[model samples]
Target chain A: MKIALFGNPNTGKSSMFNLLTGLRQQVSNFPGVTIEKRIGTFKIGDQKHQLTDFPGTYSIYPHSLDEEIVSQVVTNPTHEDFPELAIVVVDSSNLERNMLLFTQLYDLKIPLVLVLNMWDIAEKNGIKIDISALEFLFPGTPIITMNARIGLGKERLFAAISTTNKAQELSPFYDGFFPSPIEDKDAQKQEIQDRYEKLRTILPSIQGKKSSVKSTFSRKLDAIIIHRFWGYFIFSAVLLIIFQFIFAFATLPMDWIEHLFITLSAWLSGALPDGVLNNLLTQGILPGIAGVLMFIPQIALLFFFIALLEESGYLSRVVFIMDRLMRPFGLNGKSIVPLMSSVACAIPGIMATRTISDWKERLITIIIAPLMSCSARIPVYTLLIALVIPKTYVFGFISLQGLVLFALYSLGLVAALLLALVLKKFIRSKNNGFLIMEMPEYKKPRWSNIMISITEKIKVFVWDAGKVILAISIILWVLAAYGPSDSMSSKIRAIKETSLYIKSTEPQKETMIASAKLEGSFIGITGKYIEPIISPLGYDWKIGISLISSFAAREVFVGSLSTIHAVHDENERHENLQTHLKEARRSDGTPVYSLATGASLMVFYVFAMQCMATLAVVKKETKSWRWPFIQLVIMGIMAYVGALITYLILT
Target chain B: MIQEIAVVLLLILSLAYLCYRLNRKFFSSGKGCDTCAFSEKGKIEHLN
Candidate 1:
């Protein structure tokens, strides 16, 4: 059986679909998270059913691309995804508003199982629905009340589905609600108003008296949260605390992971036989993986906070407040959701633009989306901040490093808005964008859902980034370990022949040979070739090499550095990448990761479109190489200029 | 000499694997990236 789940936005329709099919399609408190139709399967007894979770829409008439999918599938009998049975999941708490789509679907004469999801929320709000009365009004349709989040009514729902093979023969509610031609706009509007008028009369009888407790509390909270001045202040303060907490809480775990990896590498280096495979294992792969994994604590914490905001319904309020600020930049309040999602990743952030109806606004949002610093840049920022920024406190509590990290994130948002303002001028649109969304009642965060989200995000990060890091590490180790012809060995021999080499201790001699061999190797030659181009940004050839490798993903910059430094100081058992970088010196005896260099690199990462994955998503979303190509060039120039200015100012 | 040959072979295999994955990510599967959140769904429902 092909079952289609449809509902108004945020009615827990996707939640019911997930409960039925046992697939975790990303569900949040807000609407439009499921912007595409998702298909999953569930089996009851010997019969299997394919369930499609269509994007939420208020009516048959569509406003956005997401809503169009619902209209396209539900209205057309010959459509491939049209369903044999439609499950109309409505918010039991808001039946009058929710039943508009249900009645419209009824006028289509399709079989529907009216699923009253969030029944618990309705009951808490003191909404008593006389189920017998509702069933009488919409005779023969199975009305099942379910709390989908907690799986309260699964068996009854299954029983209802089992009995409902087809919609029973019954008179239409409106008797040809679409009597006028489909293209007649005025007729459609009148029909909708007529439907609402009819619903108001019938709903009062079915719905018992409702307590105003929850709504009163919610409205009072919103007054302060979405206030013109207090809202922005509170939002900024919330961000300040989140960044501070990430930096403060994650340091201990990050340090332990770094130490553990360094100890393991040293042990393996001594235990394994001295050979190429041993070098690759201890110096190449282990450190590369370590560099990526050490920042898991921070990444997990970042996702946890985002999940908390989303679950608590505060994210929608943030979007509301940001809408006012975004209007001047040729963006609507809707653009903020994608920009906020970009903090996690730009790919989904760009994909989230489907919810915006205006073409010009959506395009501008897509172009500026990459300017938001994503989680991939977290490791890069953390490393650079730890390298140069002091460990001092600002107000005896705020870590100076944390403040700098927060500033970097803020800088990305500022740059995105500025770019959108510029793009808004060139792009012309006939439609003006507006946001009309429901503010879901704030609820306590679900710990299990937060944990699941954190696990999924971390898995994507480690598994996806680990592959690239390990591969590049191996290739880099090869390039740094050996050189063309007899270049490395000859360089080592030449270094050994120097009087300074003979006069040095054993460790010092090994260090000299290591330096000589690295400079003579393949990666070294390539890095040196590009050194002049990047010199104005206070980067060495080694940093230049990392810059090149990090084009695969922004997070790869850390692994690239670890691999390079691991190869450079093979004889030295450094405690961590930070320690190795700290001790590194230039040929002129100045420190390599100086304040100017570290700040410049962080600025560069903040503006650079380093992730090819992001560019690929842009290409797919925009359906053209032109936009992604333009993004690459514009961001590349911005990164260079930004880095150059930072270097010059700091130096 | 055995270790040297082993290292060379391993490098070749890793490079090949990288190329294969990249091909799958970009050209073959048309999924954005294996790392992408929507990578499991090879294609999003098109607006067109």
Candidate 2:
């Protein structure tokens, strides 16, 4: 038997689903829509049952895309996922409001098992529920008390499920509440109001409160956290702390990973015989893998804080506070979550726009979301910031490097809002967006959930981004290692015999030879071809190569550069790539990565639509090539203009 | 000479494997967002 799990948002439905399925859940889309369908299986005695967790909705009358999905599947008997049984998860502390949906489902004639979740919270709030009385009021439906967060009331829920019979007709309780085959809009509204009135009359019989007060602590916390004046201040402080934490916590692990990879590369290069296999291991594969792995600490830390903020329910308060502020930019409050999620990665951020009911707001949100500097941009930013920004203390406390990082992030955000304002004028959206979010009560962050989220995000980064980086590295290494047969060998030999090379130290001679060979290689030719186009933005032929290769992924910029520089310097094979970049000089005897060039590169990365993965996701989400193409062109122009301006100003 | 041939063949195989993985990730259907492991399957339909 297939069981459909439905609930209003934030009713512990996900917790119950997690409890039932553990790690056995599979997430897919509903047949033709982007709404996620999560399916899991569990055994009841000798029989296995499938549980489908539908997107949460307030009432069966759909207002949003997610809600429409629930209404469509539940009402259509011919639907592929029509359920044999439905479990309506509800918050016990807020039974009155939650029962509104239950009554609607009851009228729809769907058999349901009421899972009153957060029963512990209800009891602590001095609210008492008469489960048997409530069951009596809605005949044939079973009510199970549950505190899913702590894994309580599972056996009882299962027992209730076992004994419950699937009802094929509407319950007697819904007889007078709904009009049969209601067609008139005005009449439908009257009918809903009448049902609520009836529910209000019956509420006292099934629910009793020792005191009228509930959620005093949440209320007290919200007073300050959501205060108009102090809320922004608190949020700013929170963001500052999070950035500081990311830098402080991730530096050691990043250093260790970098050291480990360098040592491994050095060892492999020495141990293996001089051949393509050895070169592939040390030059092509290891550095690429290291580049992806090195950023895991920062990525993991960012997701860790985000997951904590979300799990603690503070994020919703941020949405609540920022809604009015976002409205003038043509985005609604609901766009905040997706935009924030974009900071971790834009793909998920774009996917998260599903919750917005207004099509125009959601579309604008998707279009501008990539402007938020995602974790993929972190590697590029860190490389440039470390190269150019002085690590001095500001105001005797703030690190200048951190401030530059903060400025880059802020630049992305300010650009996103400003662009949204412009897009708002052009995109013809008639729908007026409104926010109807529930602020979930604050609670201690669930360590298990946090760990799972961090692990999953890190795994995705390594495997998804890792594969592309690895491929690019291998292909690039081959191109950089072998050039046109005659010119490459001749150039190397000529450089080795030069009077300048003969007078230099052993390390300098090795460097000279490696540099000469690279210049004659195929990859070098390609870079030189594109150097004219990128030189205006303060990039040389080598940086040109990285800029082109990294379009596959922004983080790949660091990996590609590391691979190119590593392959060229045998003496500095184990030296840090940053050091090599710092010492590199242009044709005019200035450092390749001077402050002007570094700042220009950072600016370019900030505005560029560089990630093919993001474009692919945008293509899927919008289901058209038109939007992604426009995005690419517009962002490309912005990047060029922005970088050129920065370079000129700094130089 | 045999050892050199063997090493070249290994490099070719590795490159081939990488191409296959890249193709699967980028071109395959029902896998939304190649960058996110937890991304849902199926392309989003245009909102009417």
Candidate 3:
């Protein structure tokens, strides 16, 4: 039997869901992991059920993404999977504000059970809820007072689910959904407001105290974090540390993966018999693909920290602080969360854009979202940082490499805001509301929750993004592996027959040459197709292929380069891929990955909307492919122009 | 098979225990949730 658990923000609806389902829950991306949904399952009396924990919102009258999603789930009849039972959970402590939603759900009159979660919080604050009185107020339903945060008061919830009879049908509160043409919409809204005031008059009779209690610590922290001057300074400093760590500390692990892949590729070439098929699979495919996969550690680690910050109740603070600065750019403080989270990946970040209600602001937020230096850009950035940004120590304290990495991240953020401001000229923003957020009380983060969140993110990354990337990498390898020609085989033979100077120390020179010859022969031709286009962007034919392949994912470029270099049978002797890249030259013997070219590539990846998954999500969230298409064209032009300027200025 | 059955049996046991706890709080109490005094302490500190 299908049952839907729906509720408002801070209503303990999620807490109840956790109690009911326990661990039998999986979060799936609405498309893939990045634009995912949380679905949990539980059974009551041998009747197993699925519960989709939709994003919490205040009303069915939509404002943000969360509200729209819940509104669709509550009102829509055309959806194939409609709920047989709808359980509306509310906060009992503030019945007046809480009743605003309860009345609407009551109007719907589906088989309903009312759960007052955090009932414990209500009683402590000296609030008395007359359960029978509330039941009398809203007829034909079971009312249960429960504390879902702990195990207390949950069984009656399950029983209410299992055994509740159909609720008595209540007449529509409004003649229709708001803004009716027949009557003045404003007057109808006032009438609804008057009814809410009438209910408020009797609420005190059910409560022990005149008012419910709110946490003061959250209020104090919100003040400091959201303070105008101090807030921006703290935000900039925190961002600086995060970028510095990614550049300095993440490099060791990155280098290890690089060496591991190089060794594996060289070993595979040596062991496999010298054949066209072996050459295609081992060197051409494996190394090119490994570059994309190797970034999981850095990207996963970045998300792990973000998840921790969110769980610790600090991410909301960052948004609160940035709201003032970002507001002028057609975004409110709430838009900052999506922009910051987009740094991990754009799907969640774009979905997070639902927090913005104004359509103009929401569109602007979605458009600029891809510009935040997401972790996908890190691979592209890291490669450039290693090549162009010199390894010099600044004041014997900071690494120059780290400084450049930090600058790149800062540039991306600056560019995002600038673009958003430019877009403001075209968009008409309807922002009126002040920043209202439930600053979740600062509790020492539950380790278990952080772990679960990280695990969920990684699972989405590996299973969803991973699957698409892996398949695409193999296809790219094939394209680079075999063209519709026999020139590739002869090229391999020719390279082997000519080169006299051999390194005796490394045992597998012949296999490497044959593999390298195959790569240059077929994929070389393919990469050359777009070489002229990207050549001005400071990339050669090999880079051109990687760049084109990277349209599937930006991280794949690193892998494509890895494959190209490792094909020459070079192994762990080079500390990193940068050494091989440094030695690489053009047809006339000039260095290919010059300082200008490398910088241009980094700028391109920063602004380019490359992830197909992110595009799919934008299409899904915006409810049209129109937005994603516009995002692609606009960002593509910005990236090309930005890269062109950088290359031109330097060269 | 024994291990599988045991795992299933344990899962059932967990559900039954959760049901017992939920039922006691919801059916019998018929009062405010914070009346328990356990979660009330957090609320007291939170108010400050």
Candidate 4:
């Protein structure tokens, strides 16, 4: 039998879903984490069933996009044809808001169940719910109290799900939006008051807490974290820690993944035999795909930290603190969440902008959100950082490489604010709506939710990005390896002959020298064509070609560079791209990667619209080729100017 | 095979574009900023 789970925002509805389905979605005690509808499947009693997990919403009233979906699903008359067995998950600690949805569902006369999730927290806070009283009040529906964090009382929930009626009617949920003044004003008021009084009566019996102390704990947590100055400091420290932790903690797993990918690529190369097909399948495709997947550990870890912050209710405080800071940028405080999310990827970051009610704020947030250095930037940043900053020692214990890495990230944020500020003045918008967010009660985040969230991130990063990257790399290999011209192969033959001649001069390094020279012959030519354009921005032909190819994804540049440099599919052969970068010389023997060039290229990528997928998404989101066109022009100019300045200053 | 795939992709893309154009010409002139908050422009007027 199919079951539908319903709950107010910030409720442990997701935890109950995870319990019932044995899966987790990143759960934050914070409001507004799950923006899109997430669906999963499970089997019960020899029957396969689908579980549709709607975005968390407070009420059935269509206020936000999430609420609209919830209202549509619950009130769909045709849902009667299917098993609309709704298990109303409630935060036992905060039942008043949950009751708003519960009362509406009850009126629909639908078969329902009450799950007092987070009962463990309720007990800790000295708040109690009489489950028996709840059962008596909502006679038809089963009332099951559960601590959704653990498996305690979960079987009861599933059993309740099994016995519930398939199709039950529900009443329309309402917030006290307006009061009727014409129809015997006194009588109408009396009627409304009576209904409220009736609800107020059973509500007290079901919930032991008085209305005076509701959200007191949350209020206390918010007081310190949302302080005008302290809150800002706390948020900065948290962001720094989270970011620094992603690099520090994920290093081991990242190394392991790197090793795994190299091994797999080697095995694939050998398994498929030495041919065009084999080279394409292994060297081109596998390594490119692996390049993306190798970063999955860091990506997952980043999400894990974000998930924890969200679940612990710290995220809302961030939104509250950032509101005043973001206002000057023509964005509201609500835009911070979306902007923060953009650091993960711009796709969800753009989607997260939907939470901002103000159209002006939303548009500005959406436009600048991509400027945040996403996980995609990690590969490029790592490459440049590897290629330029020597890890050995610079000034102090703090790795100079780390400082440069931090600056690159900070540059993305700086660019975002500047773009937002400019657009705030330039783009005429009508929306002036202010942010109104529910600050959820702070608690230790449930581990299951964090696990679920991190897993989903890993799954998507590997499955989605890996596939496309692999395909593009192989295509690039075809283009560079064969080219549309014969000069490519003949040029490589010429290089080979020269390398043999030089064998007597440098016998030990002949093999290495020959391979490097051949790379200059094939992909090098293509890079040279783009070299003139990129030279102004301080990029070499090699960096130019990688940047051009990485339009598909920035991460693929590492694989492209690795392949071009003739790095073997082995860990030992993977030279530090940074030292190689520093030592790299042109045919005329001048240094290839000067400080001016590296800084300029970095600045250019910061503002330039590089991701084709992002462009396609922007086209879809704005529902016009016009917005993307405007975006390309405006942001592209910003990129050019920014790169020009960086090159000038650094030189 | 890559050529075949590319050909099919181009065909499908153009076909979809044609359908989109036809739909826009016939259906409500394609929303014209259904959710836009800009009060200066007419509700039906499209943004460049």
- Number of the top lDDT candidate: 1
Rank all candidate structures by their lDDT, best first, as comma-separated numbers.
Answer: 1, 2, 3, 4
* Model 4 lDDT per residue over A68-111, tens place: 56666666657532336777888777777567667766666557
Q: What's the TM-score of chain A alone for every prediction?
A: 0.95, 0.93, 0.83, 0.83
Q: Which stretches of candidate 4 lie above 4 Å from their native place? A: A79-83, A166-202, A211-223, A242-290, A293-297, A358-360, A392-397, A434-455, A484-486, A489-525, A567-580, B1-48
Q: What tens-digit string does per-residue lDDT give for candidate 1 at A365-398?
A: 8889989999999999999998999999997988
Best by TM-score: 1
Model 3 chain B, TM?
0.55
Better of 1 and 2 by DockQ: 1
lDDT of 3 at A650: 88
TM-score of chain B in each prediction: 0.59, 0.58, 0.55, 0.59
What tens digits encode model 2's per-residue C-alpha lDDT throughout A39-79?
76778898788877777776777666667778777778789
State the DockQ, from 0 to 1, for candidate 4.
Answer: 0.04
TM-score of each: 0.94, 0.91, 0.78, 0.79
Identify the CAPRI category of the predicted complex in candidate 2: acceptable
- Please report, as a residue range, the 10-residue window in candidate 2 chain A with the lowest summed lDDT: A24-33
User: In the order shown, what is each candidate's alpha-carbon RMSD?
Assistant: 2.5, 3.7, 11.8, 8.0
